[model samples]
Target chain A: MPIIINLDQVLADRNMKSKELAEIVGITEANLSILKSGKAKAVRFSTLEAICEALDCQPGDILAFSSPNPSQGGESN
Target chain B: MNLNTFFKRLIDLAFYLMVPIVVFFPGTILYVLMFPEQTIINVNIPYVENGFSGKALLFSMGFFALFLLFFAGLYQMRKFAGLLLKNKLFSQEVVKRTHKTGTFFTACALGSLIFIGINSLFSYEGKISVTFGSSNFNLLLFLLIVGVLFLLLSDAFKKALAIKEENDLTV
Candidate 1:
């Protein structure tokens, strides 16, 4: 859950539609939607590679890590 | 025929057969109780003053209740088999049915033990005898073991279903 999918941002930057990306990546629209909505449990490396190839961007451009509880920094009780 | 179709027909046949047993078994018992003389089977209690005394009726009712519990377990099994034919093995419904079946079997085993205990208490003879070597006792023990196994299986299915869902969402 902490690993955020910035697919929408990347798609927007590439000036591409979800349908177009899905067609090029050889995945169903529903799966693409799941990835975009951050509902996916995991994204396969092959899928990540395909998405990166399609959008002409790095995997970092699509994935971001954000702390769920940012204020509860490096110390544990 | 292919294995799936064969199994489907077998399950269907079993389901139909079980339906009548589930429905008519209680009805037959009630009829037998109502007209004891009309039936071949004599309803008699050993050492009781009357052939069908209040105590005898109470024991019959206890037996009936236990039978109902056993039938309920069979019904759950039927449901589970139906689901299996549909290829829905890992569904929540299957888990629930299995768990219920397990519960009914366990309850029947416990209920039988209680019935035996009560029967022993009510016997006119001063002797208290609990026969462990009887066929009925063995059957009850088997049912108890089977029930616990099913309960454990349901727990396993629950964990498997969670993992399956997670895998599905993994894309």
Candidate 2:
């Protein structure tokens, strides 16, 4: 739950539209949104490679780990 | 008795069987709504008449209504199932209402079947007898009550589910 998807940040830096990237990445808009919202249960390695190649960024630039425990200063219920 | 799941299955099966029956039986809306004076139900037996010929129109209408009910039930199942799968919506209160509604619809369907069956069984053809009786009476009341119960129940569950949705932004 704490796997942060910094998809929006990557798009902002790359000056890309989410829809365009979604199309280029061959993913549905809804699936792309799930990635954007950090609600995706898992991201395919192929999708990760596509995102990295598209934005010309390393995986670290797009994903970071966040603890789900609110006591650890991350999102929680 | 899990009326929702039970009736839901019945509704799904009935819809599959009845959709073509309802559609081909009447090509136009007006045709389905307005009863034909006399209908020959079985073609093989050149002289077999149906029970109260135009009444089959009523039966068809009832079946069509069942189709609508099935659609609505399928939709409700989809919504609740999505919520359940996504871990987004649940409350003991909601579960309780679902139980009550299952009971209500089951009771309504059963009562309708029983009353219609008994009255039709005993009554003579073309008798002005009101066994299911007076327009403002018990049968009419039961129909009205059941109809309103389903309408209100559907609306209430919708609102309750909406309230359970998480906005994430903590508004």
Candidate 3:
């Protein structure tokens, strides 16, 4: 629940647009936005690996921990 | 992938299931009218309680009504797949159809209830008793299924609509 996506900074550092990163990661622009905006509920490890590899960053650079989110604790509906 | 499209397809599948019963019920009546003595069963009359085709009608429709659940599953899968595609594989209008999923089943449920009501009102001489038949259970089951589907669709629509408000925030 505390996992964070710092894809925005990574993209900027790598001179990559969100769409470009999404294409490289085998995802969609919308999905990239969701991940970048922290609206994504879950992230596949494969996706994280792809992103890390593309931006030449470690997973630690893209992810951080914050206070637990209520929505992340359990099923919403 | 759009939630509306997913919902609409659910509606389509429900109709696919319902259309047959819709025609079958009245068609059976017409068949009966055209051939009244065709339903004959020379069972031994000893210790006989009313046995009627109303239950059969109910069960048949129950099977038909049950198909919407398959649609519901399809909708869920489609929702996930659409999300994966992020509106590229599917469209927004179609995904939101999940909002109206209830209306389709509600109409079918109503039709079923109407059928039950109509059947309840009439008992042809020598026809089976209406009190203890497969019809009664099916009536209740389809009603429950329809009610639940409506509620679920309503909830799903709310989630889909929430996106617009998020858009407002970003804009």
Using DockQ, give the best candidate's number.
1
Model 3 Cα lDDT, one tens digit per residue, B77-96? 44544444455323354345
- Show model 1 residue runs off by greater than 4 Å: A73-77, B1-41, B44-49, B124-134
- Candidate 3: regions farther than 4 A off: A68-77, B1-171
Candidate 2 lDDT over residue span A29-72, tens digit each: 88788778876666678988887888888998888878867677
- Any idea what lDDT model 2 has? 0.58
Query: By descending TM-score, how would the candidates be arranged?
Result: 1, 3, 2
- Top of the candidates by TM-score: 1
TM-score of 3: 0.34
Worst 10 residues of 3 chain B by lDDT: B43-52
Model 1 local distance difference test score = 0.80
For candidate 3, the clash count comes to 15
User: On a 0 to 100 scale, what is the lDDT of residue B2 in model 3?
Assistant: 69
**Chain B TM (all candidates):** 0.76, 0.38, 0.39
Q: What is the CAPRI rating of model 1's predicted complex?
A: medium
Task: Give lDDT tens digits, candidate 2, residues B64-152.
Answer: 56445544444444444444444544554445444444444444455456545654664547656554445434654564465556557
Q: What fraction of the reference interface contacts is present in each model, in order? A: 0.70, 0.00, 0.00
Candidate 3 local Cα displacement, residue A71, angstroms: 19
Q: Across residues B37-154, which tens digit of lDDT does each residue of candidate 1 receive? A: 6646554544335545566667767877887887788778778777887889899998999899899989999899778767777674876556656567788889899888889989
